[model samples]
Target: MEVTNLVVLPAVLAFFVLCLYFITKVVRLGKHPNLNLPPGRLGWPIVGETFDFMRTMNEGNVLRFIQERVEKYDARVFKTSMFGDPVVVFCGPAGNKFLFSNENKNVQVWWPSSVRKLLRLSLVNKVGDEAKMVRRLLMSFLNAETLRNYLPKMDSIAQRHIDTYWEGKEQVFVYPIVQLYTFELACCLFLSIEDSDHISKLSLKFDEFLKGMIGFPLNIPGTRFHRAMKAADAIRKEIRMILKKRKVDLEEKRASATQDLLSHMLVTSDPSGRFTTEMEIIDNILLLLFAGHDTSRSVLSLVMKYLGQLPHVFEHVLKEQLEISQGKEAGQLLQLEDVQKMKYSWNVASEVMRLSPPVSGAYREAKEDFTYADYNIPKGWKLHWNTGSSHKDPALFSNPETFDASRFEGAGPTPFSYVPFGGGPRMCLGQEFARLEILVFMHNIVKRFKWDLVIPDEKFKYDPMLEPVEGLAIRLHPSHF
Candidate 1:
């Protein structure tokens, strides 16, 4: 009887202790008196709605996911959990304005764990004054004067890429070749690595690295994340070797301080006499390489797709490009001013971006308790603002589904409505560089060839970034100038 009493007493005490712990947790969680959180389900515990979110993203129509939620909840701002965090998705231009305009105020920049782990020490991983300093340092190299200097080099690379990869082939895979072109350009301009074999090897590694950027942050072996982490390490090791050599060359006067981005990074310093650390430089270089190539690759590939599908638009682009070519002497590379003249072509690129944004949306985390759209948001909540909310809004863009470049003619899209490169303080630093690269590629390709899509209805899916499932094959018919 004493043994039974002892066992029962301990069991009851333990049960009471567990109940009290849960009660304390509940009281703490409910501390905010009259808290009115946004309307939506948290879904399954840790996994939450991430699977559904990713599934929709993979299916290439993430807008449907947002639309369904907005309708069901009947609210512009709705609550949901993603990637194991409570998320509040803000819809429409109002949401965009609030999030972008309020950077570092009530909110700050945030990225997924995959991005943070893979791109350690990059600008995306920075915030507050540190981010600003990095931006200024980077801008010293990516600024207007520097980009203008790269115009001819970009044109030269585009011409060479076309001659080697596209000129001889009757049919070619667009995405892979375009990827090669962008990657090669990035290597040359960023690291001064011009060797084809070296570039090819690095490109393979970057391919693996990029795959993990949006994948689940599982570091286990045999996972995409593992492969990406390994690739990042290899790429960093290669960059470190190059950095060591470049430092010696710069010191010996064999390399100019203004030679390339690597030199610029090595020599430039912030106003506070702060130089970026070695790891920071390597990580930023990796980030730039991915950003400098991948987003441009997507745009360039899509431009080709749209041009093939719409011959009229292709003709319009061709006419603008031909006029620019005609103004320049034979064998003379394009200048910045010449690229500026290709406005119609730019408009087409802009419209394509609007329809199929390279990045669907981005996230920001609340730094403190804040009120948005009459809803009380608690501290530490992840906030999301989708491009689809503005880019595809019928109110902002008339006949949003239709492909019309003329929409960008005069005043263009409303502020915060067209954010292919994002906006506010954290807007993409390489946007202008991408602009020059895309315009140069467009000018070269449209003037030289008129291509037809092998698959008229080729579908693209977003495995974090939009890509053609079949690599976007096209048949090339060379045009005589």
Candidate 2:
């Protein structure tokens, strides 16, 4: 054709590049051992879906968006690339069961650098050795017995915040307050930090930490990740100081006077009578403060927002609190026995969790090729299971969108079907702690005030945590206290 060599070479190069791209897609599919994975759209390229995904991150109905993907594509597990990393969204009962298993151990929890860098933990998998030890320690602090011991503290904190902060307020943004209350409780019961001002600043720092968690990982001055890392440093220093103080107090035989989680960790020794090191103490404190406060605050905000709308439920909550408080002293500490009696409140809280999970999506990197139904999940592919999306699935819950609290009245289904705190070995460590906090907060608030929505100009929206992005605004009138 008498074509110039240069023109021919460039055309050949373009053809090869296109060929390599599709060839790689085919190779990825073939790499999976099983070919029976659930069906899904491959689209123009494996990575093209990412831009649309990021665009949808903070827009529209998340539940419907994910649902449509599964339904339209007949996809139980679909692969796409995000930020140059291949990701698969696993859906349906079988896909969820397979992905949820810690036994497979292939799927690594892919926490962002904002959290990982801040906490100095691995960005992927197994949490960190320090973080792991702290998780174990938290079991002791957040266990049933410890929660029982802390009931008085929970009640007192709830009462104090309600009376002092919320008593005279009409409409208020409750998210910040919930966060503050949870941090204060974490300080008293977990970190043993007693100074209100110190705890308040720490709480604000924690909020900043959470804000930075989902962003791209870089420490540029203006980036959220940088601020998060700085926040983490602050928290680490505070933990060190508190630990030193606790050590001093213990040597002085003032241990009897301290009853927080840090105190327990300080006093309790392993089977060999060896004490946990300073790093261990600091790591656990950071873990507990993050898990205990952020998750609880998010859940409580959702619960209160729904409670305000349902006057019938609100009335019953007040009645329930009254019945439980009949014989208790005004300033008495609450016990597991006290929380146990508030069955209705527990159910309400559970329902709220079902409807609005704090941690919306759980992301894991597939360690190896895995198969479910007709779909094949390739190794190293990031897998995201939207628990919030699952919560609203009609297949999983009847009348899924309606705010009905009756679903949890019965014995409940298999744990994975309704996992508000997640499932498997990594299920939330502070679940019981959160339940107690929710019960205490709800009990006191219902007894003291009748809250009404300020009536949004438009429908409210959810942030990453299922908290209202616009902030929870509501009016509260004293309920004949």
Candidate 3:
């Protein structure tokens, strides 16, 4: 009887505690003044609509969740709860402009608790002066000028990647192969981990890490986030091993400070002459891989998908690529000037982004109480944006459903209408890097082979970045063939 009581009592106490937590949140919601806070349901206590949002997103109908609300509420603006905070969503171009323009004034950048937990000390996790300072340091390496020097290296690696992975294969799953390529490139340029075996090991861990990027913040042993946290820790430990060696190498003048991102972070210091701590560098490098790798992979795979479906588009891309290839000899690498000439290919890439943006959008926390579009938004509320809204809005984009690369031909969609990479001051720091990588990838792909997607109308999943459920498989044919 005593043993039974012990088990039952603890269970009852836990249930009671949970009940109280929800009760408190529900009570707080009632106290949350009827302040014209946009029309939307708050869902269950504490969680609010986060589960629904995550579920809808995980299912890959990223726009559907928000669009259902917009259709149910107001097309321009609506309100909801996500990640345990009240959120006001600004829809369309106005939303993009409003949120982006008010980066520091009304709201600031925000990430989910899962992201926060994993990237606590990284640049994206910081705001105000720290964020500015770190962003400046990162941009120094990522900008167009710096990337110009890396172009040939990138071209060489891409060609080698194709030769090693895609050349001998008649058919290959493009997404995974390209993923390996991107991760490998990032390792080479970022950490100087050029060994293929080391990269394969890291890539295995990174795959586990990515699973947690959008999962529930469950830290239990079996959870995705748990596995991801472990993977990140393992990765950081690997980085530390290299960090120690790089320090010795740099001190001996055996490695250039500008050789790779790790070395750059090691040498570059703030106003106080304090270099970033090893942990900070590791965390931010993880963040960079978290941000940079997947977007490029998704874009590359999507480019393949679109080109395969539209032969005319492929022909145009092929012509542009041929011009550049003709300018270079058989084994020569692509130069920055070669990348600059890929205007049409870039346009096609842009169209792919517009149709299926890699990221759905982002979260912003309201810094001050304010009224927007006749709705009262309280302080500490989570403000969010859905780029898909603007990307597919008929009012903002003419025939938004169409895959017309010509849309980017001249003038393009309005200022913030095309926000695949986001907008404003808080825009992606890796924008230039993404451009360089994608254009380089486009150059490599078009010059090498023309391919077709095995699956028609491939379905995509989006924890955040839209990913095809199946790694995009393609039938590769050499340009010479």
Candidate 4:
């Protein structure tokens, strides 16, 4: 009796009290006072619906999760819990519009703990005046005007990539080669690191660096994320060394201010008379290289896949390329006007992005209490918008699964519905750059060969972005033959 009273009784009593506390909290969570929140289940304690959210997305069926809830509730908005936070799902064009238009006013960008931890210098983590300043500086280099100047160089690189990787091959896995091409292109355009040996060494490290950007934030040894963090640190060190040399080049007039992003960063200053630090510039460089290569690589692979599977489309693309080729002399690079003339080719790429967007959605955090879709949204709640729900919605695009590039023919899918490059003030800064790279690659490859996929039944996985489960491999037949 003494033993029971001293230890066991108190232990059991404490356990009961803890259970009672959780029960009370759960009861409180189910009731939101007078606020009319959207209809949905929070699911399980502490963990909430995080596993369901991750599992569905991991399975590459993010749209299914959103569509099911919308169907059952007949509501465009719903409440759910994800990543240990309350999230408000805003579906369709309306949801996209709200998030894109409301940046910094009612909401600002948010990311998972993993991304925030790994990508420390990214502008995505900044807010208010700071974000605006960083964006302006980056835009100075990435805007349409500046990117247009790189078209000839992009054309040259695309031609070289084909000659080096695709020209002599009987069969090749396109994803890896395309990755090498885009990453090398990014290095050339962003850092002017055109030396094959240097770019090759960096590219090997960057593969591991990118894996960390989306991996779990755990920093333990023997983990991919840990390896990623180390790779990121090493890359930063290399960029810093380059920056040191660039400062001398800039000071001595050995490099032009507009030569590369590094030179541009060296000369530019923010609105508040702030010049970026070496570390900050390295972060921006890493961020740009990361974003610039991944999206184009994915899109380029899918472009190859679709063009290969559809013969008529391939003929049309080839015809467009041949027309462009006829005007230019042998070995001459494509001019900006030549790229602009790729209307049909652009439409095809746009359609592929719609079917399998590289970046599906992003997160936002509410600034204050607000009302959306007649539902009360409390402050501090996480906001999410998925392109898949809108892209695959039958109402937005008729026969959404059908591969009709013509769907982008006239004025394209409705506003906010076609967000391959995202939209509004915070839209992808590298959109124009990506366009030039993809169109140039398409032009060069089509004029050379019409390929057929070796793996027709290949699967796509989303490591938060579209990646082929197996690198997309194909066999090429010369277009002239």
Candidate 5:
């Protein structure tokens, strides 16, 4: 009996030792050794402060929730979790610099599960020299000569969209119309497709894909993921067909074919005298389509919302539009010079993006161990930046919450301060394209009609992008010459 008892006691002791080892490992994973995380209410196991954020959105006060945290917690850096990743969120000028700095090689962009599942591409992960090549190709396509060639196409599309879409609705659900129009415009320029019905159908499928980018990742029956996957597949197939036909058309009409961006991309070689592969072509097209459609829409919606709220700003824009319309440039294709001259309008758009950036938060996973704010950020840990919070940081912008276009009057915001287009080597490739599209739409719309909000004093909310949650309800008053 004594021998049996001794044996059983040893087995029990061994089991306890193994359990203790696991507990230590878990603790280490959960806590950073040197980083002093900002103070905040980290609620419930696993959930953290996610519930608080969702509640803020639910109550239509997301900005207030973020501000409350910044006021209460340490400003330079903070910690939170979403979808189980413990993210280190950076705010203030210092935090912004740290996030945008080069010392951290581990830094990478993070995408929400829905976006990841839908787009299946990320600048933070899949990007490399391929992106640089694509960027060069785009630069060539938007140059002085190229822009001149694109003018007729741009004017025709803009005029057609205005005449067809705006002529119908008294007060339109403006966001969807803007999205559809931009997608069509992009398709026409890049794909060289002039069929409106086909383009509209493609845009709807793409919209489904975008919506799927924000939902839970279960691709089963009655799931957003499933629908998004189906939509994405359809878009991919449709694009494949479009590209295939374009290639054949280019082959047949090699000399006489239109000089759109895609044709240029197909013919032009990189410095190495090598052409992009089929996959590269498709990927770049997808990137352009995604970037062109959504980001431009976001800008237009903000312009419309703010114009509705502030009548003086609207008047200024209208006056500029009228001046351009009455000039020799009136009803003519918008020139690169024309857009450059609208400096105030540009500043207004820039300020709106600064105050109400569409993408509120970003995350970069460290590829290597790095240091920031005097803390050792471990490899595999995500370094996140909250653009909404960063935009509102008093250190970055004076009177941060107020909409003041004059802030961009003399020079742009500090590189780190105004990152609506993102900064560094990875800045948006479609920046020029988006700017031109937006300027064209604004110029035409302001010239045609005067706009005001349905409720003169309605507050706007930020959901991914700052938009009037109840839709941009506006009454259109005919402009008097």
Candidate 6:
């Protein structure tokens, strides 16, 4: 009886000890580390603060959302949940520097689920070595030197676009027409596709696609997301068809490998002989078409609005562009050198971008647990760097609300403070292209017409992109050269 009792008691104790050990481990798993997270509520679960964020965005004062929180929390970095994710909002130049400088080290580029779904396989969705390779490939064609060769083409397209669309019209809707101009340029330079009918059709589809890009991700039929998905499908199908024909042309030696972006993408491969997949190429083409044109179109449309509102600013831009025009022969297209001479004009565009940046902010996902602003940031959390944080800061720019082109002159706003195109390794690949595009558009439009806003008090909103609510109708009075 003693032997049996001893054996049973040892077994029972061993079982109880094992159970206690697991119980301790399970409790530990349920509790997170003692983290000093930034102040602010995550709002309701799942839905979160997305409603407030979207409401402010639609109201054309998205920065107000950030500012209110900054005041409420009294912190540069605050925690909030947006679009169903816990996000840490980083405000000011210090925050911007931390995120921009630490790309792929502590954090990585991340887009919302919607963007990831739509822009799959594009460079924005890629990271590390693969992203680097794709960027290098695109830079090969989009770099300033290569784009310089296309200046004559861009100039010709601008002139023809103005002549065809704005020549005799007394009043015009600036947004749609500018979109047409930018899309046409994209089609011409990217794929060498110049058919007006085709471009017009593609532009309509692209409008649907853009509308759905930042829309709520409800994929039910009749919803914006559903329509955007359909439009994307149609556009991709068309591109695939184009790719098929181009491949045959390339194989038969009927097309030059250096003819256009599509051709360049097709024939080029990484040093290891790895060529981009057909679908990858198609996806990137779509990405470029959207990025390359949409932001520039937005900037150009607003430039017209601002120039009309502020005549003194307009006169300065006009005077600068006129000097460039005066140096050229009759009907001469703008050259690379001509664009370089439009320093003052570029500054005006820069100021407009600063005042009303097309992209409000960008997102990055923490690769691992990190600390910022004395607050612990957990792994997998999203971090946002807002343009308004710096762009609208009184400390960064004096009287930040006022429009001032001279701010960009000489040294310009402090580094990382004016990131209309972002910064670091992931800075915009098309920034130089955008600079040239905006300058050329300015040179052409200001040189030809002095305009007035039909809706003198036009209101605009950021529907995930800044756009005039009324499409910015304007009256055109041709300039007598």
Question: All models: lDDT?
Answer: 0.88, 0.70, 0.84, 0.83, 0.68, 0.88
Candidate 4: what lDDT? 0.83
What lDDT does model 5 reach?
0.68
lDDT of 1 by residue, 222-290 (tens): 679889999999999999999999999999999989879999999988887778888999999999999
Candidate 4 wrongly placed segments (more than 4 Å): 1-32
Pairwise lDDT winner, candidates 2 and 4: 4
Better model by TM-score, 2 or 4? 4
Better of 2 and 6 by lDDT: 6
Q: In terms of TM-score, which candidate is stronger, 1 or 6? A: 1
Candidate 5 per-residue lDDT, tens place, 91-192, comes to: 755676666665335576566556665555423235457656666777777555566667657767877887787764678767777777788878877777
User: Where does candidate 5 clash, by residue pair?
Assistant: 106-366, 106-367, 108-364, 114-213, 115-213
lDDT of 6 at 416: 88
Error of 1 at 101 (Å): 0.7
Sequence-dependent TM-score of model 2: 0.85
Model 2 regions lying over 4 Å from their true place: 1-57, 104-108, 122-134, 256-258, 267-276, 329-331, 456-463
Over the stretch 1-481, how does candidate 4's per-residue lDDT look in tens digits?
8865765665566456645654665565567688898988777754467777767667766777888888888899998876556788988899999999999999888887667776787787888888888888888888777888888888888878888888878899998889888998999888999888888888888888776665335565556777888998888888889889999988998989999999998898876677898878898898888898988998999999999889899888888888888888877888888989999999999989999887778889989889998889888778988889789888989999998999988787899988877777678888888998899899888878878889898988676668787898899887542
Enumerate residue pairs that collide in model 3: none
All candidates: TM-score: 0.94, 0.85, 0.94, 0.91, 0.85, 0.93
Give model 1's TM-score versus the native structure.
Answer: 0.94
For candidate 3, lDDT tens digit of each residue in 1-481?
9878865776667556656765765576568668777888878765778888888787877788888998898557887777656678888888899999998889898887788888878987888878888898898899888888988898888888988998868899877888888888888889988899999999999889888987556565557888989998998899889999999999999999999999999999988887898888989998997787888888888888889999999998888888888888877887788888889988999999999888888888888888898788888778889889889988877888888988887788889888988888788999888888888878877877888888978888885677888888788888852
Against the hidden true structure, what lDDT does model 1 obtain? 0.88
Ranking by lDDT: 1, 6, 3, 4, 2, 5
lDDT of 5 at 37: 44
Clashing pairs in 6: none
For 216-253, candidate 6 gives per-residue lDDT tens digits of: 46565556877888898899999999999999999999
